[model samples]
Target: MNMKRNSVGDKVFDCFNLTGLFILVGLILYPLLFVAIASLSEPDQIYNAAFLLWPKGFQLESYRIVMENPDIWIGFVNTIVYTVSGTLISMILSVLGAYPLSRSDFKGRRFFSFFITFTIFFSAIGGMIPLYFVIDKLGMLNTMWSAILPGGVVVLNMIIIRSYFETKIPMEVQESAALDGCGNFRLLFSIILPLSKPVLAIMILFYFVHHWNAFFYALIFITEKDKYPLQLVLREILVNNNLNNLLPTMTDQNYLERLKQQQSLKYAAIVITTLPVLVLYPFVSKHFKEGLLVGSVKG
Candidate 1:
């Protein structure tokens, strides 16, 4: 066997790639680190540019202010409900939808797949006005369903999962299950699902993140303050900067403090909103990579 080493060109390319990767990692990590530090930092310190690498002055006032708001607590609960329920609905539907499409023996699978792909290329988001009318007709207006039902199964997620199932699973496995008298449901639950941990975990994460970060849907559908999601509450804080509801005792006396608080609150809100996903990512990220098993199975 000719066990020749990599050429000089390949060695140089590897070094170049590592350097690029290091730079890319720094580019991404620095901003995230800054957001976290800035959230814990004093807004005046940020304005002064005393330090950017770490919290210029560690302060919990912003977080305390944000947490003490009644609306924020209500919104947090509503958001948790929405994210968990929405992710469940989306994942189940996407997996079910993908299964039939993944089966090569299913007639017109290719045609149906093309239909799906075509929509991905051309699908436009429906206007909120028209969508509102439909939601109203369904009696979903001002309801959590208004947010969850409208986005039941994202087409792009379905497409990805269908591709995963189609290629990663072997036809031989299905045949063996059939020989063991396994019906479709049995084969799916007892076999495929058991084997699809990684993909399902990834799908759950994707759906969870999508629903958690969703604000526009809540903004249009939920009028009741208690029904608002965390993103909407954060939007109210960060964009509108309306802390009047939280502190009706606002006077010229403490006005400047409130203003300063809002600035820090913006960063704090971002950090608080993002913390769950950040904490969740490390657990699922390895599984997601395992799920994307390129060149691991035959068609």
Candidate 2:
């Protein structure tokens, strides 16, 4: 059989599509590329350049300054702990909640699901004050648990996992397991979870990124500098411009030089903070499309 040849109109459409996509990809990538390059380039060159194509006067000084700060290291370690612990908590809660809701035999599943979903819209109407009060009442304020526990279950993620279970997993497989004297916990642990790797990987990626980049709750709840996450620490450097911690002892002689280096320092901090998510996406990317398509389609 001969393949159909592309007509003139189709060729034009394909060319336009390719051109648009290339431009879109460049638009998205340019800023990230600039930041990475700027982080390594000399401060004067970075400021003077209209756009960065490559590093100029390449040096590791910005990275050295960022790494040398005790706060940066503390925040990095804190972020890792929060990301790991929070992801584990979120996965456990989301799976446990979604599994039951996915079951047709489970009573009140619809009502429970509705109740959970209601919060998504209701939360948009304003709940920050109430949430703060509750956290304060529970004495979780200024604690690491404040950041990790409050967002332990994301509703959208749970719904996605539930949709994945209901639509992707075959009922016949579950029935077969049940017939072989498999109990709920055993079946879930041994069979169901193993087969649900794609969705689980996606969920892990979602929660991991969320927890890794979270700062709002930390900004509100964590007053102690040592307890701050990486994002919050970056905020101190980037937004507040509080580079006292990152800068070496300043005198009239080197004050201008240190101030110039601040630009590189800020870009370096952003790159450092962003690197983890970039590193993580590749590992779970294989499951991303499959899981997202199935998981998000129903809801």
Candidate 3:
């Protein structure tokens, strides 16, 4: 009788768990669905919507207007450049710093580890004023390097990568590689990096998102209009209400209509900005489970 009751309770608990999981998923998905639906709807219909589930008055006008703007195109190109270059530099530096920290036998390992770890907690002093002054002194202000150099490598990412290497990679395997006349560079390039695809993918996605969404850096450093990143373009459209200012002589009669449609275009831009990471997730999602398990297991 006790076993029978326990079995019934287990079944009830399982049903409740599934129900809760679906509810949580629904909570997260509903807003994105609403935004997507609103983005495709006519602005008047969208404003009327209390809870947008589908396009009330289907329209592609927002996308057309956004595409028509030349500054938007320039900013999009600048954003792509920043994201790609930033991710590459971040990965290269992160891997180099992480590998040495992974080695327990390396001299001054603790000090080096502490030094890298220290950056994670400590906020930059004088936040942007002194940084601006320093960049000006280096003559990097108003240049591409200003965006790239300030965020070369993130400390938290380095620590996670180093932890993965220390816990997952066998010291014995590295010793075997060294015996086979492999130098540190060859061992890292030929061995460790090949096996680090999952963490690297995650890092790339993280850094890409960071660089893509970065606005303040460009806003502060880049005085030149052409160097403005996509986020700055988005800011001009959304916050400043100054799309005309971006292009001084754009005297098109549809300017008011174009600005009205930016509400939908904002969400469309978000979806576009996020698409790279979304597309990438499917390719690396399977690897994450296995990779994380490997990293978590002690060497």
Candidate 4:
């Protein structure tokens, strides 16, 4: 076997590649680190933009403001409800919709597939206006259903799930189950779902993040302030930060201190809102990786 050797030019290119990679990593990681540090730093430091990679001072005043607000808790609870319920709804519809479409022997499979792909490139016949009217007629306005139903199952994601089922799951296994008198429902849940952990985990995470970050639908469809999701509440917080007196019992001097903490509060709110999802990513990261790699490449 011939020995592998790097020429001077290749060595230079390798050094450049490593330098560029380091710069790219720093670019991505520095912002997250900076935000975390700035959240805990004194407000004036944030206003002055003094904190670089590390925080200059330690302060919990911004977190205190966020924690003291009872409405923020209500928003958290509402967001959790919406995310969990919405993800469940989304997965149910996606699986049901994807499963049938994945079967090779299903009637009109090519026709249905073409129709779905067509819609991806084209708008609906009446668009958002008619869709809103239908939703209003359903009396789903101002209810959680309004958030869950409007775009529960994305066609593109459904296609991904369909491709997963079509490729990752062997036809022989399905045929064996059918021989054992397993019906469609039994085959779907008992056989296919158990084998679809990687795809399912990724889908759940995707839908959860989508629902958690959703604000536009909640803004339009939800009427009550109590019903607002965390994102909406966070937006309102930033918009009215200086005006709202966080601690009424505090003296004027202390209140002014709190006003100075407005910028810090914005950073704190970002960390607080994003922390849960960030915490969640590791648990499903392996599945997410496997699913994307497998689902994205189909034979």
Best-performing candidate as measured by lDDT: 2
- lDDT value, residue 188 of candidate 2: 80
Candidate 3 vs candidate 4, TM-score winner: 4
Task: Judge candidate 1 at residue 165 and give its lDDT.
Answer: 75
Candidate 3: tens digits of C-alpha lDDT, residues 1-299? 45545588889999999999999999999987887777788877765678877788888766666678788789889988988998899889989998998987789999998877777788654686889899999999888889887888888778778878887777899999999999989999999988788777777776777787788778889989899888888787777766563333535796665555656777665555556667767876776765555654545
Name model 3 segments beyond 4 Å from true: 1-6, 124-126, 245-260, 292-299
For model 2, residues 1-299, the per-residue Cα lDDT tens digits are 99999999999999999999999999999999999999999998977897999999999999998999999999999999999999999999999999999899999998998999998987632578888998999999999899998778899999999899888888899999999999888878887788889999999999999999899889888899989999999999988999988887788998778878999999999999999999999999999888888788873
Question: After superposition, which runs of candidate 1 have C-alpha atoms over 4 Å from their true positions?
Answer: 1-16, 124-126, 245-250, 253-256, 293-299
The alpha-carbon lDDT assigned to residue 249 of candidate 3 equals 50
Measured against the true structure, the TM-scores of the candidates, in listed sequence, are: 0.89, 0.95, 0.87, 0.91
Per-prediction RMSD in angstroms?
A: 2.7, 1.7, 3.6, 2.4
Tens digit of per-residue lDDT, candidate 4, span 1-299:
99999999999999999999999999999899988999998887776775476776788878888777777788899999999999999999989988999999999999988988787788554666777788899998888888777767777878889989999999999999999999999999999999999999999988989898888878878889888888888888777653264545567768666666667878888899999899999989988767867876688
* Candidate 3: residue 224 Cα off by (Å): 1.7
Pairs that clash in candidate 4: none
lDDT of each prediction vs. the true structure?
Answer: 0.82, 0.91, 0.78, 0.85
Q: Is candidate 2 or candidate 4 better by TM-score?
A: 2
List of clashing residue pairs for candidate 1: none
